[model samples]
Target: MKIARLSSADIHWCEDGDPQGVPVVFANSLGTDLRLWDKVIELMPKQGLRLIRFDKRGHGLSSCPPGPYSMEDLVEDTRELLKVAGVHSCIFVGLSIGGMIGQLLASRQPSLVQGLVLSNTGAKMGEAAMWQERISSIRAGGIDALADAILERWFSGKFRQSDECLAWRHMLTRTPVEGYIGCCEAIAGTDLTASTSKLDLSVIGIGGADDLASPPELVRNTAALVAGSRYVEIAAAGHLPCVEQPHQFAGHLMTFFKEDLHVTKV
Candidate 1:
């Protein structure tokens, strides 16, 4: 792991060196760190590719600044991360709330992005009413009130019952309440309906068939709004597709980047 400050706090990330491959930045969900991508990263063919993963401002080993960080702030934070890493334009891959950040960032600064991969997220996200209620609940009660609910949404009941992946759910349990609420604010204010219509970049949208967190239907609708974006739904997976089914996720990911698109991993 490497560390750099985006603003007042130090941001942390892990890098897989592949100078010849396309530079790809992967952002984790709201509460998790760069480690969230471990399973998926394990499957990707390095083949001289550069891979980057980062803990958002409030997650992982990163510092949790004050409350109510905006989506734009998150975008800028990512921009700085890329700049510091000497990345020019790169593919932006995001999951869950991370996907929301990717949408806004790609829209706000198209020059900084070469391609986009959005998973387990929607353009409009939840209804404004529901997000408002969630924000209130999180702020008032804490992340504990939402941890089990989120864990449940992210994985299947069978997964929870089995010890297939306890670490993933455990990470959610370890999230700080303040950080969760701050990210909740970011999610609440997020809406990329207009941005999706105008993006002029390569995009591959994906979601899990059984994702309660962000359904495939929602992801399909999001892809529909993106003009010509292709969509995929991993069967028998949940919100965290990469973890639930790593090989399948990698197959979809590699096909999207290398075969379908001319992403020249050189």
Candidate 2:
């Protein structure tokens, strides 16, 4: 466990595998924290890789400054953390909001990003009104009220009925309300189309077959924005494929890293 204490916020993070090995940084989704990647990390090839996972501001053990955060702020926080941790370059893997962060990071600090993976996310999420409504609902009743609907969008119906869903629901509901709302505000304002389109790095976009939050078409379109990006869809999974299908998810990532990024070259 580690904490990157930035001027803006304190970021809680965890790392595994060799410190001197290939570096891979992971940013989680909106509601979940670093733990969201536990299953995927367990199944990933562990030799010669330094895996770093961080809880975004307002999620997990990271500090919640206030409401109405900006996409730039989130991006800056990640930049600061990487600098503080002595990471010169890495293969950045981001899910949902985390994916959005990667788009920004690769554009802003190209030298630091060797390859990019955008999973279960879009360049632009929803309209301002929709995010405002979600924020209002959270303020009125807390995140618990949105857990059921969120889980439905996150996992398939059959998975929703299983015990595994219970843990995810708990994670969603336990998220700090301020953090959730702040990220909602950020997502509402972010439109990464311009930045993502201009990126020239090795990139791959992964979507779940059953994902409703960011459908396959949307994820594919985002991938299309980049010149040579690849796309893949995992079967029977929802928004968080890394959770419901860890091995499959990890396989897609490994293929990208080994083939595209050429881990040996790094």
Candidate 3:
């Protein structure tokens, strides 16, 4: 269990693959931890990449600070984690809220991110009112009250019937309430359309065809913000394609690394 003590929190992280290989950093969605990428990582080529996965301040094993954190706070946590891990540059793969963090981070510090794989996310998520309503629901009844609804948005109907879906339910409901709500507040206040449109970095957006949240059109539109970005939609998957369709997801990542970023084994 590796941990980086940043100014505001203790981030839990893990490293894999060749130390000298090209760097790839993964940021997970809200209500999830570093384990969110476990299946995707297993499918990735192990020879030529340095894989870094970390829990955000309010999620996973990382310490949860006070409520109502900002997007800037999340980005700073990622920046400090990378600095502590000795990663000067990397291809960042982010899902859901993680993708928002990726967008803002790339805009603010382009040199640190060589490329981005934005999965099931957008520059602007739902409206503040909607998020606030969801926040109120969670606060009133706890995550369990909304777990079924959230899971429906997260997975395809077929996947939801499987036992694997139960595990995700557990993961979601187990998330600290304050942490989840804090991220909700961050998402509520963030609108990165202008900043994302100005990014000159290489980017590819992936979305689940069955996704209810951050639908394919939304992901495609966000990708279009960058002049030369690309977009792909995975069939039979929902919000978390990395979980529901990891092989397809990893294939996209490998393609982007070799073709777009020109990343090759060192």
Candidate 4:
């Protein structure tokens, strides 16, 4: 297992494809680990790319620090992880809270990110009060309490009936309470509207037609913040389109790499 021992936390990370190939770093959504990108990675071209993925501070095998983490903390952890992994510049693909991290990181350290893909996320995820309420509920009853509702938002009704949905439910309910709450607090405190609007890099915003967490309009609006960003919505999918519709999602990513970033091999 690959690990980056950052000052604040030990981040679990993994890389695929050539080390010298063009870099593409992926950041996971809340309550998920690096494996969140497994299906998408499998569909990607086998050559000429270095795909990096990591578990955020408190999720997956990473150590849980404490509750109420900040967005700055998450961004710094990712920054350090990239440095340790020897990535100088790369396209960043972020989902949900991961997308928020990509926005802040690109804003603060523009030289580090060359392109961005924001998937099923918003500049401001939700109101602080709503996050606080969810946090309280989790604290009182653990992550299992909200697993059903969260899964509903994550996948469409047809997917919810499939056996694969049970595995996602397990991933959700198994997330550490403190870790989940910490991310919730971080999401609650972040608002990337102004920062994201100032970004000049190439960007693509992807949304799921069935997404209830961050609707298609919200994702499109966030993408519109960038001067020349593009937006696409996937049908029959929800918040985690990479999981629900990997083939279509991967196609969009490959197109962005080739057309916008001018990546020929990937």
Candidate 5:
């Protein structure tokens, strides 16, 4: 229920675990809110780890502004939230558009990002025309118009037929039109390859084998941008692997933090 009242936009957010523990900030995908990380959070070890999740402007309970938000706008919103919350240094885990935000933030403030995990995302996500067409469709018929198609891209066929898929479908369809379109515009306009390539911090790129939105190849290529970044693929998962395979998804993150970054208590 916490809210960060940034001048540009009010952001909805929540935090878990010890305040003094090693900080880990999570940024969700385009259409999902902080709840997107719930299952993964539940599976993660709590001791000596601080986990934080937030709803970007126009998504979840956050205020919906005008259309066409820039990647810089999203990055600034995160920066303000972390500053107001007194979060100093941390590892940032970002999914989809969330990964783009992480790249921009880390490039701008390296001291704040100790490590990074870019999951289910790429530096340059999709062509401008594709996003524009989606935005147009959303504006005309609202989020429900493309809900089924989006879900197909987000999850595998077997998952789409499962009973649990209903809840996720609701999550996607219920998102505000302005919010969804705004984020789409941001993705359409962003290309972070040049900046992300220069990152020197610990990095890991995670992908789902069946992720149609951002395929494994795209994630692998994005990871290659950073000289020493490692890449892992979670089998039998789609775009939102954290939802379909929470344990496996969380395991990848924990392994990276513990083995590579020397984070304690996982």
Candidate 6:
């Protein structure tokens, strides 16, 4: 684990496997840290892949920037974080807001991205009013009220009653409200219509079959906008399916990145 400083924020990251191996940079969804990828990493093929996971600005141990961030800010921070981490370029695998940032990163700086795994995210995110309401609620009170709503929507009803669901409540409680709102604003303001149409990289879009946030239809639509993009859905899981169904999620990812799409000569 390492904390790399960017001009605007601190990036908390973890690296595993050989330095010379295929670099895979993992980014988490809004309001969460790199730990979101823990189960996913455990299932990743170790033969040829080096895994990297990081927390975005204002989240986890990373520095908290002020309220609201732009996609460009997130993209710049990511580029600098990778540079400071001694990474030149990598195959990016992103979830939710991280996925949105990846789209911008690949579109704006093609050289820095090789292949892409965009999971549980949409090209253009939510409506402005919806995010504003969320931010307003957090500002009025805190994440407590919102956390329950998020959890209910993120995990299926069955999972909510299980032991696994209890463990994640802490993750929700410990989150920085400032960081959550910042990402909400970013999602509210940004539009990825251009990037989805423009990004010319090997891409795979994955979603949870039962996801409330980014549903299967949403994932399919997002992928269809991109030229010849592959799409897959993990069953019996919701928003954070990577955690709930790690084995199945990783299986889909491995097939997409390794077996399905041929990587360009690196």
TM-score (all chains, Cα) for each model: 0.94, 0.98, 0.99, 0.99, 0.98, 0.95
What local distance difference test score does each model get?
0.82, 0.92, 0.94, 0.94, 0.92, 0.84
| Decoy 4 TM-score against native | 0.99
The sequence of per-residue lDDT tens digits that candidate 3 reaches over residues 1-266 is 99999999999999888788888999999999999999988887778899999999878899999978999999999999999999999899999999999999999899999999889999999999999999999999999999999999999999999999999999999999999999999999999999999999999999999999899999999999999999999999999999999899989999889899988673
Residue-wise lDDT of candidate 6 within 1-266, one digit each (tens)? 68887788988888876567778898898877888989988887665777888888878888889977888889898999888877777889989898999989998889888888889988887799999998999989898878888887688888999987766877876789898888888899998987778878788889888899878887778777778788888888988889889999888877777664553222
What candidate 2 gets wrong by more than 4 Å, as runs, is none
Candidate 1 per-residue lDDT over residues 108-166, each given as its tens digit: 88988878888988887787678778878877877667877887888877777777556
lDDT tens string, model 4, 215-246? 99999999999999999999999999999999
lDDT of 2 by residue, 28-82 (tens): 9999999999998887766788999999999999999887799999999999999
Clashes of each: 2, 0, 0, 0, 0, 0
Q: Whole-model lDDT for model 3 versus the true structure?
A: 0.94
Q: Of models 2 and 4, which has the larger lDDT?
A: 4
Model 1 has an lDDT value of 0.82
lDDT of 5 by residue, 126-211 (tens): 99999999998988998889989999889988899999999988888888888888999999999999999999998899999999
Worst 10 residues of 2 by lDDT: 257-266
Off by over 4 Å in 6: 263-266
